[model samples]
Target: MDVEFLLKMGRTKGLEGVEIYKVETDSLALTISNDKVKEASASKTFSMGVRGYVGKKVAGVSINDENLNAEVAFEKLSSLIKTSIEDPNWVGFPPPRKGFMNIACRDERIVHADYAEVMKAIKELMEIMKDEAVRNGAERASVVEGMVRLGAQKITVANSEGVHTEDECTVSGIFMVLKTVAGRGESDKSFWIVNRRFDFAELEYLGMNTARLSLMFAGAEKIETGEYDLILTPETFAGILASALIPAFSALNILEGRSPLKDKLESMVLDEKVNILDNPGMPFEIGSRGFDDEGMPTSAKVLVRKGVLKEILHNYYTSARMKLETLGNGFRRNPSSPTTPYPTNFHVQPGESRLEDLQQELKKGLIVYETIGQWMSNPYNGNVKATATHALLVENGEVKGPVKGVLITGNVYEWLGSRLRGIGREVFTSEGVATPGLWVEKVRVAGE
Candidate 1:
């Protein structure tokens, strides 16, 4: 858990530098149902992962037991590192200096939330959503158990050459499915109170909204294929952007020529209004941490500024290869990916317009709320063609009605930079990304 410990141990082993990361998590979860077929249940899980580096030769180990002493774990880790391949491009470790100071990743709610409170909240959400399903004549009414607990006491250690930091956060949420004879629908959403300072009202609203949206898609239909303007809400755009940006920001991908933005630094890559930032201290994100897995201090950097490619995420290995300093984006689920680039909290700064204003500008466009296979869709060419489950037909600057099974196709980068018309001031944070509602022009939509 201590950076100095790892450094001292590494020196004793004749290594130049050492980096260590320890993550301990406790999770409690439950599911419930009132339907005749499905039942309710609850479960709890506790786990810890330890990753260490011996001059770029990395090793990882995980345990469900926290009782094991750190020294024993490190001994096993050191043994494993001896058999690992040396990283030729390794450059010791990242600089251990904090920059652009932000809020520390500490949440009061997480420390206080108990199992009973989590269970009660889950039951409440299930009851509300299930009641709506029953009213719609669902053949089965089921609720998944709710849970509460701190997810991890995530810590990162870097020697004099790398930054070290420690912080803890909480993760808990609920999900359910309502089967209706008219059709089928599933709802999945989570609540992470990492900040604990924020009110729960927004979380409650999100739960209710998700349930209602799922219900709206029951009698969906396909649309005819044709070009149309499209509006993407904050909730829908976050995941899509994550997939696209990850590749563009990945140092390895850039080096391998897999990223289109490679060698395109300072070039326009997005809309002039779009500014993508990485914040390690985002108010309430499970991904928020003081330092990266390789002991690099997390900091905010604009990848795109005024539609220009400004920066790329980097780790020790990649940065060394490129002869650049680590930007502190290095990450690893375990030792296997040490010095790999990954995001902490990717964010898109918002605009001035309101949602209502965005809607008014949508005239003759389709508003896409959700999509399937977004993760599989390619964005390197800036284009996306995928089926949307939740959407609305708009005409004369207003929502006409619900339209389902619509395929929306468009170039993501071009559409956002060129055809992207507006952005709403309302920004929502989810899945480690906070984004605003977006409006894009001339997107191809296919349906009945």
Candidate 2:
């Protein structure tokens, strides 16, 4: 979609401003079962989204039909805006800004990668999983689904105030799941091999790591239910901590009285070592972007520092409504959606201790590698009730056996606050949040 037509028709349509987002994607996916390829497919699609304002109200429209007329879509969007309810929050669109950082977000290698190369990587991953599964005494091994997706998108923003901006990006990733069965015992695990740069080496390890987890957990045992020292692996910590903090830091939630931090600004919410950040400019990171949906330049901000709540995330609208400045976190899932405060690369700072050291310090505990329902509980109150699916029993600084059907229940704030034990130096990035292995003491664990 072009901005010239949007600008010319804005005056006649009673529209004050307009912005457009265009996206195109190509992907190849294959499934494996019984150590063989069961299905394979490829797909490509293009979509367009447009948003604008009429009077003081805003509305949006999106079209997935690549062949649709842009003029018709814009007209439809303008008509919608004319009939839409006035949103007191929709004051206006953000003005164009300068100083947007140019980073290496688009990789030609991934954008131009063909089906043959992706298949080679998938087969290589399967081979690695097969070797690891058998080495761990697995009778059956399967890569349920292996997918490599190449995506490219170009977004353009233009308004009546002469603010125009454009940016394009290419993304690449592989996702897979490995399952193993041995002696009537079965285990399953999944992982993502995603990054701007396509590294075959990283893809190789994704398979082996998932295979090892399934093999180790295939014959899980139970433990006595009791309060115990707990270690959350990086991935688990990332999921829990991100889910808990994301909503709490949203200024929109604070405005709606749903955040625990609504009145806790500048207060101590975590341990002295706890520092959370929202960094949108980190090079090659999954959430890295040049500018947010509102054409605002993205920058890094420390949401929390030394246990004190520092800055609440804000978009242009929320900042304006709250008398604060935008932190370049504005985003919309689609053009038809309203822009809101969203973290680009939210993560907790790593500490000095390693995972092995955290385990060694705990004479008796559980080392949780992953969980099932950590995000099912409420993030606002920090109450955590999660089921650990692949936890390892620890005794005297060593792993005893894999424990299954274990539940860890506690208050997350207390665990990360006064009850904090240790934080591992190793950080894992999952679904945008990067966190280290976290150790908490006296956690309530229910086991059999």
Candidate 3:
């Protein structure tokens, strides 16, 4: 698509400014059921988002038809602008800037491989899982269902203000649900691994772990309801942070009075040892990008340092309205969605304690491996309510048994504050967030 042509057409239509964002994607997916490839599919899609400004009034439209021309897009945008109210804080689109960092965001294997090659890889992964399950003593274990997906995407952003940027990336992921049958009881556990590049060894490791955990969780029992120390795996903690803690740092949420951190800037909000960074330049990370959706160059920044709130995320609109500079966090969930302030790669600096060390140090605790319904947690008030679907009880530095169906309830602020005990040294990255296992001193768990 010719974004320059779109901008020119918008200008000819008497629009003050124009911006166009385009995305092209090609994807292939394979579904596995009962240890066999059940379905395979491929798709290609294109979408364009156009925004036009006339004085203070602005309007936007999304074009999903690849054949749609710039003239038609502007026609739709113009109609919306005619009936739109003027934004009092409207400013022109951002101008082009330099200093874009180079990052490895694509994998050649995924970008160039065909369906047959990908299917072979999935078959190999399935074999690895079966072997690992046998080695771990679950001789009857099998993969019940799963999926492997590979995607390549190209993004382009252009504006009338001489801002133009383009980026391409490849993404691959594997998700599997392993089930083990022992006597008359059955246990099931699922694992997900995603990255900008494909790594066979990484997927193998996840598959083996899932198989082992599935066997261990067989005949799991619920624990008594009480307060206890909690050890959350990296995946578990990342889910909670993404759902309950990250949104509070959005400048738009703060401005709209939907964030509890609205007045907590520069204050200590977490443990003194906790450090959080919004880094979009990390190599091969899923969220790593040279420029944001608004065509602004992205950079690494400290969001929290030594427990103090340092910076809040902002996009062009929110920054301009608040008289601040854009931090390159402006992002859109989809091609048709409006740009908003969002984190790129939310990274929590790892500490020195390993997972085993933390587990041994805990006199009594529960190690949570998986959770559900974390997205239902409240972001505005920092209230967290999640059910622990996969957890193990530890007593006196020893794994007592598996615990399931436990409800974990706590406030994020309180948990990250004095309740935070330790951070694990091994950091895991998935779905744009990088974190390690987090240990909290005391939490309320509702079990039998």
In candidate 1, what are the lDDT values of residues 1-448, reduced to their tens digit? 4447655765675555555555655444344444221333333444445555666686665544444565666677778888999867656656656563555555656556665665556556666666665565554445433333333344435454545566565553434443333344443323233332323565566555554555555555566678888888886787678666556778888887777788999988788888888777776565676667765667878878888888888887788898887567877755434556877888788999986787887778777787776776574654566677778788988767677777776667876788889988888776667889898888878787
Question: What's the residue-level lDDT of 217 in candidate 2?
Answer: 75
Using lDDT, rank the candidates from best to worst: 3, 2, 1
Q: How many backbone clashes does candidate 2 have?
A: 0
TM-score top scorer: 3
Q: Against the correct fold, how does model 3 do in TM-score?
A: 0.96
lDDT of 2 at 323: 86
Candidate 3 per-residue C-alpha lDDT over 1-448 given as tens digits, one digit per residue, 9 for 90 to 100: 6778778888999999988889988999999999999999999989988888898888888888654766777788899999999888788788787889887898888899899898888888888877777787775878899998899999999889999999899887878998887653688889886778888787888887887778778778999999989999998999999999999999999999999899888999889989999999777778898989988888888999999999999988888888987568889877655688888899999999998999998888899999999999999999999999999999888999888999999988888888998999988898889998889988999999
RMSD of each: 4.5, 2.4, 1.6
Give per-residue lDDT, candidate 1, residue 373. Answer: 66
Question: TM-score-based ranking, best first?
Answer: 3, 2, 1
User: How many collisions between residues are there in candidate 1?
Assistant: 18
TM-scores of all predicted structures: 0.80, 0.92, 0.96
Better of 2 and 3 by TM-score: 3
Kindly provide the TM-score of model 1 when superposed on the true structure, using C-alpha atoms.
Answer: 0.80
- CA-lDDT, candidates in order: 0.65, 0.77, 0.88
Clashes of each: 18, 0, 0
> Which regions in candidate 3 have their CA more than 4 angstroms from the true location?
66-70
